[model samples]
Each structure stands twice: as structure tokens, then as C-alpha cells.
Target: MGKSQLMEKHPTGKVQVRAALLPLVLGAALALSGCIADPQPGPTDGGNAAVSTSAPATGELPTTSAPLETTNASNKAPVYWVGRSNDDFFLYREFRDVPDQENPVTSALRAMMSEEPLDPDFFTPWQNPKELATSISGKNVITVDVSADAFNSNLDADTADRAIQQLVFTATAAGASAGLIDSNQQLQVVVLVDGHTGYLGFDHIRLGAPMSRSTGMVAPVWIIDPQEGTELPEGVVKINGRSTSPGNKLRWRILRVEGNSDKTSYLSGEVTASADPSQSGIFALSVNLGPGKYELRVSRILSTQGDSEVNVDSRGFVVR
Candidate 1:
């Protein structure tokens, strides 16, 4: 347990949380832990499906698209798929069973193309025709070639922009996680339609440049540890997420949910986030609990005025 400080705002944007005692300020015993990043949202209302488009006559595997090396030792791999909500796009993780040897990028993209999300809140606007191929280069750039149907995403420009991000974020994250991209480096991707260029989406984003993860395009906070649904062997769990913190601070809470009611079980004692505000700060805390089932939420107040939560991520899990 350690003494923590609360940062109080004074109408101006700048505020600092300190270790000094302040009356009526939120405080408690706290322990720091490690962090990681990565959530879903509800479905869109009246969202349009991608319009069908005729496949180009030239849609074929390219000469440079050689057969990918298969690493058949693992039966399953982690993959990311993009799903749409009315306001934003979220990346959801799913484990896919693969042959002993398969290309990581191909495995992930096939899942993205062929499957619909199991969660109700998420939907993919792209109609997967299974005419997709993938290859990686030395610069860690992944090239995803799909049939002309890839360009048939009928979403509005804003939703289409998010749809593009959905593809970029899902492929990039899945690539790195599967070790196709170096873990220490960021992943970039290029989408190719029908073995050639000259294809554009509703967002009008050209396909020439490599794409990286833009955090603003997705949910701000994700529960990075203990995963989404797992049986905790111990009473204590390490919780972490990525987000821009207000006044250099982040907050977390654990609630025990019984039947239809929620009860507060633990409040993080003023744990601060990683100092980098430009990047989503890494916030972490270790909490001990005697629980059955709990809902964990991590949030931060980005505004100085009303103290409303700007970004929040939640997860539900059971503890034994």
C-alpha cells in the first residue's frame, strides 16, 4: 500500500496530482502492476451492407505472391476482426483453429473475410468472397489482395473511413500478435484489390501507402490483462489499459454483480498512468478480492469542466 495524491482541477486545463495530503480527496492503499492494450461496442442502427460489385476479370494471384511459409506447430492463432458501431469501429479478438502449418497473415484475413462477429454489437461491412491473398515484406509491410468485392463496402464516408481503419487495425494487430511482424515494431499494411492497384473505397483512401493503428478510430480503453473472460486462479488480478489520462491520472473500479444488481468491490487508490499523454498512457493496478463474478471498468476524465468520463472500457469475469 502506498500514499496517493488526487489532482484537483481549477477551471484551467493544467492540474497536477501530488502525494501531499488533501482533505476529502479520494485515497486508499494501492499497488502497481504491469500493463497491456487491446474491446467491443453495440451494433449500428440502419447501417447499410456493402453493395455487391462485379469481380474484375484480372483478379488473380500475383507472381510476387509466392506460397507463404507455414508454421504448422500451433493449432490455433489469435486474430483481430473489425466490427462497426454507429459512432466507431472496434477491433475484436478471436482464436481461430488453423492447420499445423499456415501463414499467420492469411489465417487472420480469412477469418476477417469469411466470418461474422459473434458479438451482437459488432458487424463487418465487408462481404468476404474468400478471394483474398496476403504476403509480407522485409519492411514489415503486409499486402492484402482481395477481389473487387472488397471495394464494395457501401458504408458512408465516415463509416467507410472507419471500415478502412477496421481492416488496417485488425490485420496489423493480428499480424504482430502472431509474430509475423516484429513485436518491438509497429505493423503497417497495404490493401490490394484484384492483384492490381486502382481500387478505392467509399472513404476515398488510396491504397498505395502503408496503414498503421490510429487509436482515435477505435475504443479508447481496453482491459489488457486477465483477458475478457477467464477463470482467475488467485484472488488478486492485475488490470491495465491504454488511454489519454486527464491531469496525468487514471481510475479503475471492480464491481461484484449478483443477479441483476451491481455492487462496488474495489476502487483503485489513485494509480497514475504512463507519462506520455501523446500516446494512450498505460494505467495499471493490482487488486485483491473475494468474488464470484465481477465487472471491471477503467476510465479517465479528459475534460476539466464537468468531470465526465471521456473514455471507458469494461470487461466481465469470474473469480474462484
Candidate 2:
């Protein structure tokens, strides 16, 4: 399809001709899933954690070139950020409120490059680009055109790869969540720098080729609700998060912040994620507490033979 045809198909806005040439790649299947759960009051010591086992939905791309109307009135979109767990870095996500005028893909990329993550542990190496836009083809390929300034951050090869995958995951998640793309098919993302290809990313990975989500790029465990520095009511506090280790035991601890950097463990226990291998690891538990500053830490329970290194995610919040 040509630029004029893409514009005619998407009448909502004029298509920005940012790329001199668009590259196409074979599509591969990619599965993206998230867990949503309502917290139910349970024992604080060791309660039955709620798990979401909902099946993944497959979406069909609209036949017409017109832009797909999104029913997500909340204006919230998913944006992935890079964070460290143990010695390795991984991608973490946050659902941010975006402008309604922008499509999910654009909103997500802009946020990923410019916005700070809700969790202090998460950060983005991407500098805000002076120009950025995104378009999706019928083949489920998303093309992103961004300014070269976005790659200003200095990073090693491995970190650069994770940073690029951060964009891929965010764009795909945004499209899937908005029902703008066909989720049943494999999706790929191609990034362009200032209407051209072959731009080196972070002085490391070369751009222009189609990229998909890389394995082991996502954090093993992440706290989804009660984000960092959130304030909650002084009653039953519900904690929710996701884990990559499904059917595995997760150890959780609630620490009371005593000083500027000191945290004394208040409550600790273990909860098992859903045993169903098909479902994403969604775990939820609640604890009643009085008003105070606290932190929630969660990590997988490794066996004796496993490496001593642990991957953990923690969120600091206040109960008022």
C-alpha cells in the first residue's frame, strides 16, 4: 500500500510520510497475555491467592483501511519500561493514561520514550524523540518512525537489545489491548529513524529489520497494583502482581519502612501461582494494616539446587 492509500484508508488523520521505504517481513505468532483479578479479603499470614485463568482472545483485523475505533474510553494504555531484577535487566509495564486524540501505538511509544514509570525501580533509556509516528499494515506489522535523537542513551549491546524489545512489547501490547491488530497472528515491529533505515540503535544494534518480542526479556515477577509511592486507605490492603514462573511458589513480604532507607519485615508468607500452564501467572493477596509507610517484595522460591541469585520486584506504598 502507498502513502496516499494509507491516508485514504485512515481518514481520521493524515498519514505522516516519515519513512522513505517500508520493509516487510514474514509474520510469526506471538502470544501476549495479562492477568486481571479482584482482590478478596483473606488471611494475612497465608491466604488463598486469586488467580486469573482467562483464555487469550484472538482479534481479527478490520478489512477496510479506515482506522479501527477503540472502545477503551479510559484513555489508559500500556507502556513497557526497563528495570533490573537481580543482576539482569528486564522489561516491566505500566498502564498510563494517554491522550484520546492519539492512537494506542503512538501513545505507547511516546510514553515509553518520555514518561517515567510508576515504579521507581523501572526506567527508560530512550530519549524523547522530536518526531514520532506509527502505522500498522494488514499483515500485522507495525512500523515506527522516530527521530535519531531517541537513541541518545548510552548502553551495551545486551541492554540495547532489551531496550529495543521494550519498544516492541509496548507497541504490540498497546495494539492488542486496543483491539487494533489481529492478535491471533504473529506480530512484528519495524522501527525507522527520521524516515530512513539502517540507523544504529544506541550505537549498538542496527535498526530497520522487523523485530518481535525476545524471550527472557520480561521480569520474572512484577507488582501490578499499588504501584510505587501509592497511598492506600488504612484498611484491607490488596496486593496484586504477575509472575513469569507459573505453577511455582512465590515468597512475599510486607516491610515497614522505619527510616529513610531502613525497612523491617512485618509480614512474610508464600503463595503458589495458578498451576494451569496455559494461564499467565496472576497472583493476588490482601493484608489489613494501619496507617504507615510500607514496601511489598515478591520473589520466586527456588529449590536448593537452584542458583542462589534471586529475581525480585518490590513496590513502596503508604497506607493512610
Candidate 3:
């Protein structure tokens, strides 16, 4: 069958076609894979109906945002979403609170499929499956059984590849974060549709094989702390995040959100992320500001002459 005719067989083919054409029409501003940026405001709290305010006691899994302060918990688990940086589509992660009873891996996948990311710029194309489950073998292989309905979204080859990695990254992160798997060992994921193998994923990629994280799939830079829509007391607000390729230095800026969409630069500087070969690029800085909405942006310095930067990551916050 022809590409267009083949796509038409899927329920969401038209929507996927529009999404694929968006980047061509809007250029870098709307660059993305099958995932499209959300236009709405406010935190989604993952797929959870409500966010709880009470903190879970020590030694217990936190199900609410209350423990965020004392425990320094970002999100209950890491859920990867697709987004664009430097005009290229890549996977970005957001720590999110999943349901209390749900397994970390399952919850993360569920959230990735159904929930909206806190940042409006990030999104996912996976649909929520009616049934989902995960099991980890001693060999560090994670088996994911998801209902076939989760593959409802039609995607092109590139987006399909990214979508698969989204699952791999999220499952492994969840497993390691929850102590269900050894972080020191190599891990792989095998996806099964409706508990059966050999199911085609998004009508593009063949499934039921051992899959590992693909290099160059993740965003080169990502804001890790003071997540989008965070409200902080006036003081020295700490800004920290991860960078995959922190050459020599990274640039940062704080822009105050003035009127509706206007942003006035409040602070700008250069910072260095850790250069340790054994660890990913980690950087931190602190800035004090008065009560208002602000954005923290970071980027890799590509060149010293003129203005050349790439792989930007930013987050919006409120200084209370």
C-alpha cells in the first residue's frame, strides 16, 4: 500500500498527518515528532485526577507533592515526553506522581501515554491502554505488556523510533528509580501488545525485541529542578539541570514574564556543568528575584564568535 493510503487505515491518520506537516509549516517553532506541543496552561499532575497535599511518612513511597520539600523529591517517577530543542525532536523527561497503587514502571508508562507534561512545550503521542503491566527479569530485561489500543496513534518511521525509545527510557528509569532493577547493570526492554509478541508498533516499527536506549534520542539539555509552574518563596532560588554534551560552558538566563507573552531578561550568565566522564553533565546556580512569573533558560555555547547556541532547555516558575 502507498504511504498515505496505508496511513488512512489507522483511526488517527489524519491527525498524525497534520502533526507531521506542522514542523514544515511552522518551522523550528513547532518542531516535533508525532508529539505535538500542548497549548494549555497549568500542571497536568500526570494522569492522576487530583494531586494530594499530605506527605507520606519516611520509608514509604510518596504519593503526594507534600514530601517534595523534605525529601527533595522531584516527581514520583521519571516519565519521558517528546519535545523539540534546537529545531530537532528529542525526548525530554518530567518527574511525575503516578497513582499510589500503580507500579513505578507501569505508572510511568501510563502517565507517558495519557498524561500531559507540566511544560506546555512537551507532549506524547502514545494513547492510554486499557491494560498495562510490567515485569523485570533478574537479567535486567523489562517486559511490558500493553493493550493494542495504546498503539492507536499513527506515526512515521522517525517518530515511531522515538516513541519506542520513549518507552524504553521510561521503563528503565522507573525500574532503577524504584529499586526494582540494578542501575549498575545494562537494562533492556521488550514490549508486547496485549500480551502477545511480534505486534507492529505505531504501524512502523517491529516490536517484541530487546531494545536499549538509542544514543542521541534525549535532549542534550534539560531543566531538572524548579519544574514548570513551581512557586518558590522569595530567596536564592536554585536552578539545576542535566546536559548531555556540556562542551566547556553553558549559558543561562532568567526572563521575567511581563504582560501576556512578553519576557524581559532579568539575569544572564555562564555556568559550567560537571565534566566528569563517569557522570552526565550536571549544573546548578542560584538567583534571587521578587514575586513574579519567570523563566529559567539554559543552552550549550556552540561558538564564541557571534551568537551560536543549541539544545535549549527552559522552565517557567513563580517567585512568591
TM-score of each: 0.63, 0.74, 0.77
Candidate closer to the true structure by lDDT (higher is better), 2 or 3: 2
Order of candidate numbers by TM-score, starting with the best: 3, 2, 1
At residue 283, what lDDT does model 2 achieve?
68
Per-residue accuracy of model 1 over 258-289 as CA lDDT, tens digit each: 77665655433334444332223345555555
Q: Residue 168 CA error for candidate 2 (Å)? A: 0.4
Q: Cα-based RMSD of the predictions, in order?
A: 18.3, 11.8, 11.9
Please list all clashing residue pairs in model 2, or write none if there are none.
Answer: 18-195, 28-186
Top candidate on TM-score is: 3
lDDT of 3 by residue, 129-219 (tens): 8999999999999999999888787677777777898899889888877778877667889999988889989898889999987666767
Taking the tens digit of each residue's C-alpha lDDT, what string does model 2 give over 106-215? 99899898877777667776778899999999999999999988887656677677779889999888898888898767788999999988999888889999987765
State residue 281's C-alpha deviation in candidate 2, in Å: 1.5
State which candidate has the highest lDDT: 2
Can you give the lDDT of residue 175 in candidate 2?
92
What overall lDDT goes with each candidate model?
0.50, 0.68, 0.66
Model 3, TM vs. native: 0.77
State the displacement of the C-alpha of residue 135, model 2, in Å, after optimal TM-score superposition.
Answer: 1.0
